[model samples]
Target: MTERMSAEEFRAIRHEPKPSKYRNRKTVVDGIKFDSKREAQFYASLKQLERAGQVYEVELQKPYALTVNGQLVCTYRCDFAFYDAIQKRNRVVDIKGVATKDFNIKRKLMLAVYGIDVEVIR
Candidate 1:
């Protein structure tokens, strides 16, 4: 059986006080902005990358520590992160089949922090 945190325990997490590296990663693919099949393409690419050993899956909502001025200042829980062991670097990823306008702004901000790039999955 999978053990999970209770709602009360999970509620204690102070997410709002800090910022996440992957705040909003989804946008609508139904409209002209994105083709309906684009989502399929994105997932395909992600799978291909995984099979090629270029990237490995990362669990969602897992916290990563970021240090500033020799002090651990903040934490970010990304939707997903791919680890390139060879390069010793990681790529943060967020997947959204559809998203709202507010999500767009948050996503852009997340991209700016830590020089991380953003990928809109569909």
Candidate 2:
């Protein structure tokens, strides 16, 4: 025999946000959920820049596929992408507190294969 919980209790237990493997707590802002507080702050700043017309456009979670020798190796997802109206250049940003070996490998593959330089914000 087991005791049944109410809907709110179930939701509280089931839908609670948990810390990531690196202990980065998730944050929600403007109805958009972000992986970390730093990411969320960056997003807020981007929104401000957009409003100020410094950024022409803003994109979130942009993915780049890395293929080697005609075979797909992996996909690296960027935190944010935007066009700088002042600099007149496109920017791909990754807000990283820690860089893993997998990320380092993916970064090399990205540059070697696509010539895309990822901008890292620590």
**Best model number under TM-score:** 2
- TM-scores for all candidates: the values are 0.39, 0.81
Candidate 2: residue 50 Cα off by (Å):
0.7
Compose the digit string of candidate 2's lDDT tens values, residues 1-122.
99999999999999888657888878999999999999999999999999999997798998988889989999989899899999899998889999989888887887899787888898
Residue ranges of candidate 2 with Cα displaced over 4 Å: 1-19
User: What is candidate 1's local distance difference test score?
Assistant: 0.57
Q: What is the lDDT of residue 11 in candidate 2?
A: 91
Best by lDDT: 2
Candidate 1 lDDT, tens digit per residue, 12-118? Answer: 78444553344433344323232234443554666677788877864444565555566665565555567866677876666565665755655554554466665
* Candidate 2 whole-model C-alpha lDDT, 0 to 1: 0.90
Question: Once model 1 is optimally superposed onto the true structure by TM-score, how far is the C-alpha of residue 42 displaced, in angstroms?
Answer: 8.5
